[model samples]
Target: MITRTFSHLVLALIVFIWIVPFVALVSTSLRSETEAKTSGFWTAFTPTVLGHRFSTHDKGSTVEFIEMSGNIFDRLNGEKSGFLVSGEVQSILIKARIMNPDKPGKTKLIRKLVPAGEPFETRGGSLVFQSNGDFTWTFPEATAPKPKKLDVFINQDPIFGADAYIEVLFDNKNVPNALISSFIVTIPATIIPITIAAFAAYAFAWMQFPGRDWLFVLVVSLMVVPTQLAFLPILQGFSGIASWATALNAWLTDCEINDSCQVASKSFPSLWITHTAFGLPLAIYLLRNYIVGLPKELLQSARIDGASHLQIFTRIIIPLSVPALASFSIFQFLWVWNDLIVALYIGPNNASDLVFPIRLQKQLGTFKDQLHLLNASAVISMIVPVIVFLSMQRYFIRGLLAGSVKGG
Candidate 1:
């Protein structure tokens, strides 16, 4: 009983830790700017309305109280200069003003307006003018008013619905493009590396040749080299290719082959080559180990039956190594798909060529005011990674032991 109780407690604690951040993110996403600024999301359950007293010295203490649903600025919709009068006051006038920061006594009137018996509409909140010129704003009111019900829309309040997902998928361009680019980069990157590496791994494992062990060791050593060390060299190589392509185009105008030769060009092709190069070392190492572990009897029997190396590799080795191949493909696909560093470095910096991460970063400005959009963008970026992880997870476990033993 004690052990069971302890297990339950641990499970509950783990669940709480896991859920807290997600709850907070959801709450923050749904919270209005005012709520986020003033109180925690937990406090939102017990709501409060802002109350303002509208009165003037000339009005002789006939004060009007206004209950508002939201922040003060929201109630004064673009009108800064205004006298707080009784709701019964006809021809109510209000003026919008900005307090001068440099000059204390001076007020700059930005706008003037007459109360139209309607309050300004904002997300999750509404402004209502009392019979006196005093206006009160309310948000998600405890009891909605009767007769003419006021609908308050508070912007930036946390919503507990699937709207977050919808907004991320449809509204966010970066996420979608990132997802698409991931697929584009991943599919070709995975397929090309696996195809080439499978052939190389087969030769290294089955074919006897001088310096084979040394070559394999060198390839494996390349794996330990930090990827960052190659960045500048790769960049320079691509830049050189771009330069060569430009010069070749100029020369093509003078060549007889110009009519038949289409310029075999694009940064994308180069990026594909780069991904293949980076992926090849690991792919070969993994597949070589798996292939070398396969039964030598199968290859010998196929050879006695007059099977060429090509025939044996194609017919026996490939059929048996499906798991290893699948596993490697999954690994390469996911790595290439989620790679922002490579894409950013190789991709064109312009909007037309910008990948998902760059586009998401573009949404976030240098100032704090752009935080709402930044939050929205962050949610957008996570969608593709989630999808990729879910789709490829099965291969991880299923293929690890594949081709290691003779029988399944």
Candidate 2:
């Protein structure tokens, strides 16, 4: 009982460790740009003090007395999602240049706080401030002091909204297209490999063939080979196929006449094939391990009833291997969904064809200061993988356990 309690505590701790970053990511994504930058996600629910720097309007050499009256909050960068929910002035500091007490005939610049709800007299103006961020300034006649900079601090209630998500999904053209492109690339890339691997794995587990064990061993050995090593040859092969297809199309139709032929190397089929080829070794290995563990009596009974190998595979093996297939599907779907390196190397180069990872990466450079949008994009990217895993979680555990030991 004590050991079980301790194990539960350890599991809870591990879950908490995993959940913290996701909570922070979600909190940051839901906040305004000001809130995201000024405070950590932990401080998101409480009131926060944020500082802003702005200047009074310049009169520009006019010798007339003028009054400047405006809400100091208006000087903030225009974010209209009620970001300054119930804002009040916490403090204000005004810049001033004064004669240096230590150096003769020299001046230095300094800032001093303007007391709340009080008129503070300046060299050119007298200013009155309010806690709600309203301010009035009356300048003396013929005094043209340069625009004085004011550093204002405000205490504001927290506000949360979907502005970041809206911008990421709708405002950015590439993001929406990249989302479609990701679905287009991921679905086929996942299904094709699993379909092919199932057949190969069943053959290795049940079928009688010459050199079957040797072939299965060779396939398993391929799991250790780095994908990078095959890049050159695969690319060359794809390029050759593309060139031949292009020439054939050009000769047979108006493609060359209209100058409309496209190189097939950078299309969706090429990417699907590349991912399928790379994923096959592991897929077959895992499926074979699981399939080998199936009840041998079921297969023998099917054969005794005069069922062919194909019929037994379709009628018996495929039905019983659901757990394993679903498990591998989750793995392949997540991998292809999050893949940037493979897609960038062999996938389409056009803007409309770029995947989510490449598009999200470009946002880092293009919208460097818009981190809220980036966080929103990151969260959006995780949604599909989370759904895939959750849907198949029951099978995942079963598949791992069943595949661990083979049946006689």
Candidate 3:
């Protein structure tokens, strides 16, 4: 009993810790601006609708009540008099009534008895009345409008649907731009580092060289350096390169004969170079460790067979290192995809050059009144990361042992 209880407690605690952040994010995303400012989502169930009472002033006269439901502007749709009545019909009393001319025998009266003490005021249209008795009614201003009902897979609350997700995803323009910029940085960042590192790793493991240990040590030391400290200098350098490119463009445009050629050649190769530089040290270290652990007999036999270093690397080492490479690629891709700071510093922020993450971040600021779109954007930003993780999971599992055993 004690063991079972302990296990249950552990499981419950784990579940709670995992679920809490997700719950909070969802709740906050669902809350309206007014609700968010006034109270939390926990208080959503409290009734927000208001009520008012309407009574006839004339004694001994019966008043018929009718209810109408539609958009506020639709109140005037079928009425003979387009004018809406509001404010006090007399001192200390307001009147609200809807006109119904269809009834032949009796005068039709409509009064909505809302929650008392409601402070909303009607606008643009009024409730018309053809009552025998003088009547008074009071109402509060309309609350925020609810979304149209949608029925899909058990009627998900509008707050939890695509709209809400988009709002969260695109809440900031920087977010989407960041996502795209991450991809731009990651794909080449992963490929360039791995390619160079593979060659270096092969040489370090197989080729005898003076100061190899010292060189490896230098590479590893870079990993310990704080990335935050390096950011400003890197950013300044990138800005200098961009400035140079702009100057070059101005020079090219000054030459009328080849202005179009210069415009066509304006790609920022520096972006890729920066990512590769930042990623290279780690890549070389990881691939070197994996390559050095390969079976020496296989390499020796290849040498005896007169295979060149290039041939051995291409035919043997490269094929064997797929799992390690795949794992590293996934990591690099995700790292770049989620990066906003690096993209902001390295790339242009104008519409033509804006990345997906940046676009999502901009959307977030404008989403105060557009909850649905915000939710959709949130979901869009999450898609690539989720897909990448799922696709690369197998390689990650397999790559753990790539460098662990020599020939096991």
Best-fitting candidate, measured by TM-score? 2
Write candidate 1's Cα lDDT for 300-337 as tens digits: 99989999999988999889878788778777866776
- Model 1 worst lDDT run, 10 consecutive residues: 82-91
Clash pairs detected, candidate 2: none
Candidates ranked, most accurate by TM-score first: 2, 3, 1
Candidates ranked, most accurate by lDDT first: 2, 1, 3
Instruction: Give the true-structure RMSD of model 1.
Output: 11.3
lDDT of every predicted structure (CA atoms): 0.61, 0.85, 0.56
Regions more than 4 Å wrong, model 2: 1-17, 53-79, 98-108, 122-126, 130-150
- Predicted structure 2: lDDT: 0.85
Question: Which tens-of-lDDT digit does each residue in 1-408 have in candidate 3?
Answer: 999999999999999998775555555555544334445445444433211223222334344323223322222113523212222211112334455568655555444432222332343223333221122233243332222211101101123223344434465454555555556656776688778878987887788889987898898788787666777787777667667765787776765565542222112355566666667777777677787887889999999999999999999999988877877777677766666665666656566565666665776676664543554555556667779889888987677566545421
Superior by TM-score: candidate 1 or candidate 2: 2
- The weakest ten consecutive residues by lDDT in model 3 span 148-157
The TM-score of candidate 1 is: 0.60
lDDT for position 361 in model 1: 62
Q: Which tens-of-lDDT digit does each residue in 1-408 have in candidate 2?
A: 999999999999999999998999899999988778878998888878877776665436454546777677776544554554457887788777789999989999988877668887765678888997778878766455666667888787777889888987887888889999999999999999999999999999988899999999999899898989988898899899999988888877888667878666877888899999999998999899999888889999999999998999899989999999998899899999999888888899898889999898888998797778889999999998999899899999898677667532
Q: Where is the poorest 10-residue window by lDDT in model 2?
A: 76-85
